[model samples]
Target: MICVDASGVRLAQPDKVLFDGLDVTISRGDRVAVVGVNGSGKTTLLRILTGALRPDSGEVRFGRGVRIAMLEQDPLLPPGTVADYLGDGWEVAAVATSLGVLPLFDRPTDQLSGGQAKRVALAKMLAENGVGAAAEHDMIVLDEPTNHLDLEAIEWLEARLVSMSAALVLVTHDRHALDRLTTQVGPSKVVELDAGRAFVHQAAKGSSAYATYLDARAERVDREAKEESTRKILARKELAWLRRGAPARSTKPKARLRSANEIVSGGPRDLGVRGNDLELGAGSTRLGNQVVELVGVGQRFAVDGSDAVTVFRDVDLVIEPGARLAVVGPNGSGKTTLLDIIAGRRAPALGQMKVGSTVVVGYADQHAASLDPDITVRQMVAGPLREPDHEDKALLERFWFDSTAQYAPTRMLSGGEKRRLQLVMVLARKPNLLILDEPTNDLDLDTLRSLEEFLDDWPGAVVLASHDRAFLDRVADHVLAIEPGGTMRRVPGGVTGWLEERSTRRSASPVRTTKVADAATSSSAGAGASGGGVAAGSRGKQKQASSGPSPSTIGRRLRETEQAMVKAQKRVDDLHAELASTADHVVLAQRGEALAVAQGELDELEARWLELAELQDG
Candidate 1:
């Protein structure tokens, strides 16, 4: 059955046309997604599909008696508290609890932050979708549903959506959600909005719709470039014939001549720009001995005039030059608070933080708090200068803010455009230390990849908190996981290891209460695998005040221990597999012998690694 059918759709903004004569149809069990650049009308398309916004000229029809639930990017709640808005029911409670909305149930909806509002909206939408009821909405549309959600919440939502019977339509920049929904459990469709056109791709029976669409789109762009080249060649030949053949030129057919002239004057097809992604030049300032040091740092928040709630406690962190640290944890687990304290935006409840004299911090917080909404993009990039220079204009263009967009007020820009502008402003000053909180939020995939590339060779210290697993894998050298109850751990295998440990724990205890500090993983680096830690590279050495070996000596030993630990772990795994599958007594004996040796080596490495971590903490 058809859920929604729209044809001959056309929408135009004051500056340019969004889409023209676009056609889309959503059927039962269809998992459809919308993808595009920041201001490429993704949200606008969603609005048109959900009947919230009417197209200039289009035919939209919904299946008879089919119910629809739509979650907007920034939903306006009815005037009331969250409890009043959501009402009472076990189904609502379950969904709200899973989404971390239970705590805010008594708070007024209008007082909630952007993330809180998004979660409330998501919970309401899921509840209405008949999570545990017989009659549910036929279709559910969500705009950036994964925004502000932690990794665990995102996976939970993904599972819920997979189990539902309702058709799903969502817009997001999350690669994991997109890939899993479109490939793992799907016969999905992807609607790609590019260059004022909507290209709908239908996945094959066992194929990945999103991946296929990307490949096909790149091929299309390449084909267009080739055709443009062919046209130019033909046009050049015609020009030569017209200019050189003097007497015969007058005798040539006037219609053919006009056609040739038009082709010669016409510009090339707008396949895309050469380098639309952000180009980040590393900071020029040389970082001193100290980057940012935290001693016994902790944060506490008072709740509803009651006792102050402790977020995290006793976090002793040292960020030196060439260090790439990524923080991960569930929502409201003090990831952002830790980053804020490091950036010196807010002082910890109890701690001593020392900022190096030579350090210049460039912070990109969750919200674009530093921006003035009324100012134009050009004005923001130009700083206090009266006008943006030629270089400033070029810089804006590189970030995908065109000439028209550059002059437009920042308030008018899309969510992604605003985020991009924030990056431009932050990097413009060239800081040696970067503290990014949820930097991947609202950014398009192209810009995200470009940033990952930039950080691969960035000569500075980076501390960021993100729920983007792929982004963390590419950028972070160490994984700093803050479990619920403020017990931070250092995992060896980056995000993958942290995820495995989280999954294993969840499996072992199906029902567990959070915020009760686990005694097993007491502090940041005392326990757990110890390969992922501060990389005191050749660029600079840390200055240690405690009585011990020099920073360089420990750093060298730490690197050596990490490499040996990896080999030892691998050997142990191989031997264990051999012992499990073998029936030969001789083979079993040999494998056992090898396993013992490998285990002993791994234990020594872990102890040495832990000792180094304690030294760094001291």
Candidate 2:
């Protein structure tokens, strides 16, 4: 079923049409993810799709009885209880409980933080879908869904997406979400809108649609290479003729004489622009008895009726020397709360927390707000170094901060540049412990990758919270999964394993078989293997299969199917638990129906998998 078919969509910008004569079709069961850099009209396209704004000359047709739900970048909730906004329905109550928003049901929405508000908005949206009973809506759209969410909320949201039956259209920066959810669904098709025309391309798996731009870039490089080669050959021939006295028999070989003069006058000169060679010296600092320790730590913000709304409770954690730990959870699941406690920014409500005596903590918040907008990059770096006249100029240049940019105020720098500056300033102090929150946000992919490379070599211990799965996989050595109810669990294999486990849960297949196939396909075909007969191919296949069936392989596949079923069960359990724990009448009633559906899915998947396993065993 087509949810929306938009054609001739146009936007006014850059004194040109953004996407005039454009056409797009969103259908049921489609998980379409839109990706582009900032200012690339992603949000504008979303607005057009949702019918919030009209196209300049086109029509947007919605399927019959399609109930579209959209989560905006900044979702607004009314200043009433969550239950009140959600109509006190049993379905609403059930979604709220499972999403860990049950505690906020009776509390005023105005008291909720940005993260909490987003969670509430998501719950409300899901509740409107009849608490995942059936796809009443043809489609649901989410923009930047993971923004402002804690690690736990993000995980819950990811789980919710996996269990959702309706078609989803999402625009997000969360790489893990894109990789996992998109894997469960399929590759995102691109509807490239350029110069009043739209071109649709079927993106390949594991490759972004934006790669078309790279293809264009490669063509440009090829053209430049041909031009350079022709110029060099012509110059060489001309020089050879000129050296032979311009062909004594011919009248002064005009072309050869002209070419020689031109070469002499316009010879290439070294511009003295050195390539990027950033050298961060490896240094170590002694970590005292305890780098950081949190025992029964809890935090709550004061609100009416509730003494304090607990973000986390009874959490115990420790960061020893050289520990590269990662904290993950959903939007409001207390990853930030734990980070704040570690950074000495927030005191734990009910437990003891300590930092080592000699520890110097360098904290980088998501917004890079620690920077002084008024100061120049040189001044910022030199401020702490206390050596303005020293090698600070060279250091700034090495980080790609040009001379002019180095003198410009921090406010004038781009987001990536600012992040680089932040790194330069923080590393100048060479703190033994680094606390980074959402460090990959707003950073370009190159810078994100570079930072990961830098962190790998850095000797300092790191405690980071990031939604960038690739970055986390590269940097984090240990993973902490924070769930609702303030429970923190140490997950094995860091971010890669956590994501693999999550993907396994959603895919209903063994992760190992898929990975093995992928690995085999990616291996290079040797000269002999490339054109060899069927015998060579059979041998290759045998070799590939022989490399198989480790315990992790089976576990991953089982875990994926198991995780989906388990997640459904957990949602149902959360509803029951909420009903028993809270006196909120509306919430208790609302959860009853949602619990039934979740229990149904759990029962079905469980039985199906068990039967399959038993048949194999038999």
Candidate 3:
């Protein structure tokens, strides 16, 4: 059955059109993935199809009584409780529980973090088991749904998508998910958009759609080269005639001289796309006997108001100067916490954790929150270095940050750009030991591949926590598994062995009651009181108390927030700004909307914070 049909759709801005005369049709059981750069109108097209946005001109018609569901990049949910959102049905309850969202039933929607909200949204989407099959609206669209998810959540989503009978259209950057889920769904079509033009190709795992695109790009380059040669020849002929004492019969060529001049003077260049090349220095740092050693390291905390509950215990691990260790476990298994303890970002609850005398450690946190938001690309790169004018610019350029981006703030950067920046920052320290928690998250396939190559060549020790099977296989030589009972074991093959062990353990262990705890109390309570619940009156009182603080303090906080937003914006803006300033002006002009959106979000956040402060005072 036909699921979606959009005809002659047009999306435009004041200066240029994003998509015009675009047409697409999705049928039942179709697994389509929309491929494009950060702002090639991929999400816009999804929104248009989901009826959240109207096209300037065109018709979008769904099959009769289609019960379509959409998981947006950032979904705006209602303010009520999670149960209200999921309804009071048994199937809904089962799905929510299985997805670990049922414990959030009593929690307010506003308190949910990005990852938590994503899980809630996924639970809501999958609540009606077989709804796609039963209701005859076997169609679902997901936009960047994997963002902020951990490894376990990603695996769960992949399984859910594979089992669905619906036609799934997804826009994602996760290659593993795409490879597994899309393969299970069979050969689906791929729609690639470039410069408001759609290129459709049959999707295959390794050598299908991407190969076709490469061929097309090669052909375009050759054609453009020939055109350029012809234009040069014609220009020489015109110049020669003008220079000589010319006859009246040679007044003008067949084609209009002005038009030919336009073509010759302004034509697209033979631009070749180069992938990421992250080369780490091979000079090893001298180690003082031991790099990192953990003896009888254990972590325990109170669970549901009970006595200290053990998450992991009796874990003894050691890393020399050049050891590469991969930590693997299920969601909420404390892999990240253990890394944080070893990196000195967090203190261990018990036992001893130590770094060698000569070791300097660099840590890339699970969420990449170490970045300072108020700084420019150049400032971030040249931290602690003075007069970084030429040196900083060159370094940034090496990481694909150009002139415009070097000056732009970091707050506006995309996920991939921020990640690249983080990698550069971590490498700048030249530490002997590197601790990476899910380092491949939010990175593109090409970048991930480049990182794998870099890790393989680097001489320093690495402790990596990741769920990316392919990445672990490439970079990790030793595997450490955090078993369900909080014991750490050295496994055989890095990721494969870990997976096999997990499967065996799951099959052998008796099923326990899985409950989704409140999000605020789950992993965030010890860090801050932000997620904790307070009575409405008490909350108001606290707000009033904070508002009464000195003007200078309020100003300082506001300034900090502004700076943070600026830093984030700068990173995002630098990537595109650098690309635009260096690339063809026409392409720069074409990508204006995306840059504007990034800037607008930063502005909006600043404005919202200011508004909140004012409300608090009033």
Candidate 4:
């Protein structure tokens, strides 16, 4: 059944056309994934679909009794308690509990942090669960749902969506979700919006539709390139004719002459196509051998003016030159605080934190406070530098802000644009040590990819705290985790390794509590709250009293061992493929190292499988 259909849609922003004569249909059970470069109107299309905003032209028709629940990228909730807002529905409570926001039921909604508020808002939406009597089936629209979610929460949300009996439309940059969760329902279809036009590819369900769309898009790109080449050739001829001041030029229509001129001057811009050679400029500072050091460094805080809490204790870590570390933990875990401490914005309550003399830190916190809404793009780019100059203009253009936008106010820029400007401001200083707290929060796919590419070869020390699994895997060489009870440990296996462990833990313990759920009351919750740490980790090590697998548990152990082996081998194969295809010297070196690690892990898995097999045979 058709849930909603949009026909002849048109939306335009004074200077740019967002959508023109676009058509879209969302049917029941359809899991549509909307993807495009930033400013390509994905969000606007979503708003149009839900009928929250009317398009300049066209009509959106909803099937009888179509109830829509939307999770906007940033939602506004009226001031009230979380419970007051979500109502007392069991399903809603269950979702809130699972999302780790049940503890905030009594907390004023307005007082919650941005991340907390996001979770609360999501919980309220999921609480609806698309099962109300108002509609035949609920249509759920989510924009960047995983932006603030941790690995475990993301996994839980993915599970919930898979089980949900509703039509789902989402916009996200998470490749994993696109591959794993979403699948075409009924007839296969792909609806991709590029600039204002919609391109639909029909094929088999699952990845086949996505694959077909990509192939078709690539062909279109090739054809356009060829057409542009021909246009340029003709434009050059026209220029020569015009230069001669021929009498024939006067007979030609002025509009035709203008078109010829535009063709000669780089032609009319296709805002949708960004030249792949996007540069994130400003090389980093020359780092000395030492970057930063923490000796017995720990943080603690007083909660309710009584009990003292430990964020982390007796943590010893050294940030080496050109090091890449990803800080990870549950919500409220001192990931942000940790970054602040390392960046010298905050001092450790205990132990010594030392910064290398050569280190000039560039910090971009979650709040993006460095940005000034009243300032123009040029002003923001110039920042502390004396004045905006030609170089600054060039830099802004490189980051995708054209001449007009460079002079426009920063407040008018889209979320993605603001993030791009923020990045420009941060990197322009050429700091040797870079600390990014949730940097991927507002960045679009293009910007995220560009930043990841830049960081790959950046000659500096970097520390990032983010929940983006793809981003973490691409950029982090190591991981610093704040486990429950404020135990800070350097985990093995970067983000991938940590993810595997997390998955295992979820399977072993079905009911896990994040710091957001247990922060106020648990003894160590105070430590997590006071020290600004997150209370999440393995439920300690599971006790293995038996030397070998017990007869009752042997079957489970055998299955687990087999699964682990398969996963390890897959990692080895993926690493090998990456190593073979990569051309960048730095990337090849990184992949080579990853291949070695995967090989070692595969060997260990094989050894463990053999041990488990022997135990079962006995």
Q: Evaluate model 3: give its lDDT.
A: 0.66
The model with the greater TM-score, 1 or 4, is 1
Candidate 4, residue 530: the lDDT equals 11
lDDT of 1: 0.77
**TM-score per model over all chains:** 0.81, 0.56, 0.68, 0.79
Best by lDDT: 1
Predicted structure 3, TM vs. truth: 0.68
Which candidate model has the greater lDDT, 2 or 4? 4
Total backbone collisions for each predicted model: 0, 17, 20, 7
TM-score of 2: 0.56
Quantify all predictions' global Cα lDDT against the true fold: 0.77, 0.64, 0.66, 0.73
Note the residue pairs that clash in candidate 1.
Answer: none
| Candidate achieving higher lDDT, 1 or 4 | 1
Candidate 2: Cα lDDT at 294: 66
Return the lDDT, model 1, position 245. Answer: 50
Q: How many clashes would you count in candidate 1?
A: 0
For candidate 3, lDDT tens digit of each residue in 1-618?
887888988887564466778778887777777765433577788888777899999999988777678887667789898888878777676666556676678888999876678878877787654454343347889987776555555666788787777888888767667656556425466666655666666655434444454467568668977987887888777666556644445546534455455655665541312343455555346656577767667787776696666666666565765566777766566788888888888877877877788988888875555577888877887785565566456556656665776776778666657877887777766777888987876665545666786776566778888767777777665677665556566665556666666557557964523432222124321110010011111111223333353332343355456657877688666857666566677767656756777777788778867874684244
Error of 1 at 149 (Å): 0.8
* TM-score leader: 1
